[model samples]
Target chain A: MSADVELQKVSVSFGNFYAAKNVSVKIEKGEFFSFLGPSGCGKTTLLRAISGFAEPSDGKILIGGQDMAGIGPNKRPTSLIFQNLALFPLMSVADNIAFSLEVRGTGKVQRRNRADELLELVALSGQGNKKVHELSGGQKQRVAIARALAIEPAVLLLDEPLSALDLKLRQKMRTELREIQKRVGITFIYITHDQGEALTMSDRIAVMNEGELEQVGSGHNVYEAPHTPFVASFVGENNAFYGTVISTNGDMVRVSSQGKDFLAKAGDLKDGKKHTFQKRDKVIMFVRPESIFLKDQINQADNIFSAIFKTIEFEGNLKNIYLSIDGVQDVRCSISNAVETATLSTSESIELKFSSRDAVVLPVGPLAVD
Target chain B: MNYFFNKNGPLISTYLIISIGFWLIFLIIIPQLYMFDLSFRPNIPTLLRGGPDDVYTLVHYKHFLFGSETSGERYNYVDVRVFLDTILTAILITLINLCFCYPIAFYIAKVASAKTARLLIVSLIIPFWINELLRSFALRILFAGEGFINNVLIKMGVIDTGINFIAMDVALYTGLNYAYILLMIFPLYNAIETLDKNQLEAAEDLGSSMIRTHLRIVIPHAKAGIASGCTMVFMLTAGALATPVVLSSPNTFWFTQLIYQWFNMNDNWPRGAAYSVVLLTVSVVFVLLMMKIFKVKIGEIVR
Candidate 1:
C-alpha cells in the first residue's frame, strides 16, 4: 500500500527563477513525511512536481523505483487532496466520496457501499446523504480524506489542507490524520507551513527556505540539532550569538563572542557534521530558550553570561526574563513561573548558564528573522 | 417599499415611490391591460371609431388561432403554422447558438490568456456595433449568388456554380445566430469565470476524463448561464421580424412578419394583439420549461 518517493536532483524553473532548485529527497515507504516551509518557498512546487501537475525542468522523479516523468497525475500512483478540499459541492456527500469510483466505471451499489464504509471509517456514517455545505469544517476535511483514499493510491499528497480550519479543529485533525495514515499504512507527504503541525505528525521533515532544502531529518533531530542557521531560527525560538570559532575539539568547538569564549557542540568528525567548521571560522551559537537556566542552578558549565534584567514576559506556565548584556544584542532566559521570577527587579543584574551540549555552533548563513 | 425609505430619506423615498408607480402604470400594467382588452374584443378599424363591445368575447383569440372560414377556404391556418414554425425555428437557433458559443465561451473564460480574451471580446463586439437592420441587410448581400462565400468557394475549387445560400434558410440562421451571440457568450463567461480553477484540476486529479469533467462539474456549474442565454436567445429569435424578412425569399414569412402584416398591412390590430399575447405566453412557458429542465432557479438564471 505504500511506496518510496525519490527525486534525483529535480529542478523546477520558470524562465529566470527556479521555484525549486535541484531538490533531492526521498520518503521511505509507510513513513509520515512532511515538507515544512513558509509560503512561496517551493515546498508546494516540489509537491506539485511529484504529483505530476508541475513538470520538472530537469532530473527525474521515481516512485517505487520507477521513473514517473511521462506519467500524469491520473496515471501515477499518487492522489492529492487540494488545499481548498475541492469537494464537488453539487454532489451529495456519498457521491463526492465515491467520485473516483464513479469515474472508474464501478457499479452503483459497490461505489455506494465503499462510500458508506469510508464514511464510517471517517466517523461520518449516517451523514452520507447530506450535501457538502451541511457539514462542519472538520467533517469536510474528513470527507476530502475519504475521497482521496477511495483511489487507494500508494502515496497521498496533502497541500496545507488544515490551514483553512480553526485552531482547535486543526489541532484535533493533526492527530486524526496521523492515525489514519498509520491505519492505512501508506506513505503520506504532508505540506504545511506550521512547524507545530510538522513536529506533531511527521516522522521526518524537510525544511525548505527560498527554494532550497535547508535540512531533512526526523522531527527531534531537526528541532534539537538543526544543521543551518535558518533551520535554527525558523524551526523554533532560539537566541543567537554571532561569533567565530577560536578552537575545535573532537566533537565540539570553542566559540568566541565579544572576547568571551564558550564551548558548544559542533558535530561528529567521523560524520563530517556541522559542515566541518574549522578554527577561526565565523559561526553562530544557538541555544534554545528552555536550555538556559539561572546561574545558581548550574555550578559549573562551559558558558556563563551576566546581564541586567530588563523585563519579564508572563506566558502562563513559563516566563521569559529579557536581559540586556553588553556587546550582545540581548539575551533571554526562559524560566518556569515561580516566586523568584515574580520578584525579579527591572534593573537587577543576573547571571545565566547553559550546558555545552545544549548549545550548538554552526557556520553562519541565512537566519529566519521576523 | 420600506427599502426605499431605509436607504433614502423621506424626500428621495417619495420620489422613488412616485417614479416606480409611474413606471409600472404607464410602462407595464397599462400596456398589458390594453393588450388583454384588445385580445378579448372584435377588430374595430380606426375609421369606424367604434368602442369595444359591452361584453368581452374570445372571438378575436379564436380567429387568431383558428382562421375564419370564407369562400370555403382556410384563411388564417398558414399563419398558425407560421407561428409554430417561428417557435420551432427559435428553439433550433437557441440550440445551435449553445453548441456554437460554448467552446468559444470556454476559451474566453477559462483557456485563453488575458490578452487573447480581450482581443476576442473586442473582435466579437466591433462587428455588432453596426445597426442590426443594416447588419441583416449586409448579410443578405453576403449570401447572394456571387457573394463572398460563393466566390471564395469557387476560387478554392470547391464548387463549380454559385450557391444560393439565402433560399436554403442559411442566411436566416446565420443572421439570427450572429445577432444573439453576445447574450449567450456574456452569461456563460460570467458563470464560467467564477468557477475555481482548482475544481477542474481536482477533477482531473481524481481521474475524470475531459467529457466526464464537463458533464459532472463544468456543465452543471454553468447551468444557470445556459438557461439564461437560452431563454434570451429563444425569445429574440422567435419574435424576430427584420432578419427573416431581409434574408429569406418572398415566400418565407416569420410569425412576427405575419403579426406585422395583421397590424399594419391588414389593419387588424385586435388579431395582431391576440397573436402577440400568445407569443408572450409561449415565451414565458418556454422560460419556465427551460428552468425546470435545467433544475435552475429563476433567480439563478437571471443572475
Candidate 2:
C-alpha cells in the first residue's frame, strides 16, 4: 500500500518570509524518509506541504504518479498523525482507532472488529474499551499509530510524534516505529528536530536549515560523509580546525594554521588539477573525536599533534578527554574505556595522534563556527 | 496555655461561616421556607385578611388541583389550559431560539475573521446591556400595524393591507425573544471556539466530507456547548413573563404570568407559591435530564 512521494521544487512562503524554500525531494515507495532540523527550520512546513495542509506556492506534489495540486487534505491518500496525537478524548480506545472507518459509514460491529485487529497489531489488544485519558503516554502513542493505520493510507505523515515522550520511551519507540513501518510496508514521512531520532529510525534523511534542504542521503552518509558543514556539525560530534591549504599532492592536501602544518586526505579534490583552492585559501579540517588517539599508544602517522589535557570526563563507556592543542583551541578527544586502568586526570600534558585518512578537508564556509 | 494563642483559625472561620451562611439562610432558605409554609394555607377567605383564626385548610391546594365552582359560574382555579399553553409555547420558543442561535454561534466562533468576530460579539453585548423593557418596547413599535415593516411590505407590493404584526406569535418568537437567543449563542460560541482546527482538517484528510466532518467531529466536540445553550434557553423561556406580557394579548398569558395572577390579582398566594415551586422543579429536572443525555458534567457545561 506504499506510494512514492515526489515534491518538485516546492516553495512555501508566508507573506514575506519563506517557510520552505524551493525544496525538491523524492521519497521512494516503502521507504522511511525524515525531515530533520532544529525548530523553526521549516521541516514541519515541508511535511505539512506533503500532507496537503499547506499548499506550495510554486511546486507540484505527486503521489503514485498523480498530481496533488488542487486536492484537499481529505482527498489525498495520506494520513497525518499530529504531534499531540489529537485522539478523541471522549471516544473509547477502539472507537478512536476506528474513527476513519466510522466516518466512512461502516457499521459499529465491523468497525470494532477492525479496531480490535489493529489494536493487537500495536500490542494493545484487550484495552479497546478503555478511554483515551486512561492510557499511559506510550500506550497513547501506539493508539495514535493504530488510528493512522486504520485507514490504510498509502503514505503516513508523522509530525514529531515522539517529541512529547520522555527520553527512554522516545528511544524505545524509535525501534518500535521502524519495525511497524516494515510490517505495514507503507511510505512513512517523519518530521523531527532530534538528530538521534532521524538517524536511528529513518532509512534516508533530509536535513533542513532555515527553510533550505541541506542534504538528502542514507544515515551513514549523513553522519560520516556529510555534503555540507551544517550536516557535519548537526549529525554528530566533530572537532573542526580552521586552516589554509599550503599544497596539494595526489591524494593528500597539506594545510597550515597557527604555524602548525598537517596533511588530510583529499577525497574529492586532486593534486595539480587546477583545483578551486588558490595557495593559502582558507579551509576547514574535520576529524571525528574517536579518531584521535593517545600518542603513547599510537603509531604516529601524518596528522599527529600535541596538546594539554584540560579535563577528563568519565562517561562509563568512554572517557571524553578535553584538550587545548598547539594550533587548535578547545579540542575534544573521545577514547573508549578499553583498559581497566586508572582514569585520566586534569592539568596533564598529553600527545594525540590521527592518521591522514581519518581527517576530511572541507572548503571553509561561513558556517565553520558553531 | 498555648490553646488560646492557636484560637485565630477557628475565630476567622467562625466569622466567615456566620457571614456567608447567615446571608444564605436569610436571603434564600428563609424566604423559600416561608413560601412553602404559605403554600399550605387556605384560599377561600383570601390571604389579604391575615389571621390564624381563619381555618388553616387544604382547600386552596384542592382548588388548584381540581376546578373551582363559585356561585353559578365554573372558574378554573389552576387554569390547566393556560398552563399547558404556556409550557408548549415556551418549549417552541426555546427550540426556535436554538435553531437560530446555533448557526450564528458557529459562524462567530469558527468562520469569522478575528476582527469581525470581536465586532460581532461586541454588537451582541450592546443590545444585552439595554433594558429588556426598552428593547421590548422598541420591538413593539417596529411590529405595530402601520410600523416600518408593514409600510415596507406594502411599498414593495408584497401585501395590500398593513398586517397585525404586534400581537402575533411570530413577533414574540422572532423580535421579543431575540435577546435570550443572543445570550444562548454566546456560551455556545465560547465552547465551539476552543475546538482544535487541526481536528477538522484531520477529519477531512481521512476522506470524511465536509458534512461528515461537521457531524462526526465538530458537532460532537460542541456537544457541551449545545447542551448548555439549550438548557439556559429552556430555563429562561419557561419562567419568562416580560416578553409575552408586553407583546401578546391577555389570552396569551404565559405560565409565569398565571403565577403572577395567583399572587397579585387573585390574592391566592398559596397557589402562586405552589405553581412557582412546580416551575422550579420542572426546570431543574429538565436541566438534569439534558445533562445526563449529553453525558456532560453540569459544572463543565455551565462555566
The estimated TM-scores of all candidates read: 0.95, 0.89
TM of chain B, each: 0.93, 0.86
Itemize residue pairs with steric clashes in candidate 1.
none
Identify the CAPRI category of the predicted complex in candidate 2: medium
Q: The CA-based lDDT of model 2 is what? A: 0.82
Lowest summed lDDT window (length 10), candidate 2 chain A? A267-276
Candidate 2 residue-wise lDDT, B1-303, digit = tens: 245436657777678778989899998999989887777766656554477655566665556556665534355544666767766776777778877887888889888999999999898888878887778777877888888888899999999998887556666766545858776797788888988877776677777788877777777888888888888888888787777777775356678887899999988788898778778877888889879988899987787
Compared with the true structure, what per-residue lDDT tens digits does model 1 show for residues A195-272? 999999999999999888888888998999888888989998898988999888877888998677888988422134
lDDT of 1 by residue, B59-114 (tens): 76777666775524455677778888889989999999999998899889999999
Best TM-score among the predictions, by candidate number: 1
Model 1 spans with C-alpha error above 4 angstroms: A267-272, A297-300, A338-340, B1-7, B47-55, B71-75
Across all candidates, the chain A TM-score values are 0.95, 0.93
Off by over 4 Å in 2: A250-252, A265-275, A325-328, A339-343, A364-370, B1-15, B43-65, B71-78, B104-116, B151-161, B249-251
Per-model interface RMSD values are 0.7, 1.4
Q: How far is candidate 2 from the true structure (C-alpha RMSD, Å)?
A: 3.8
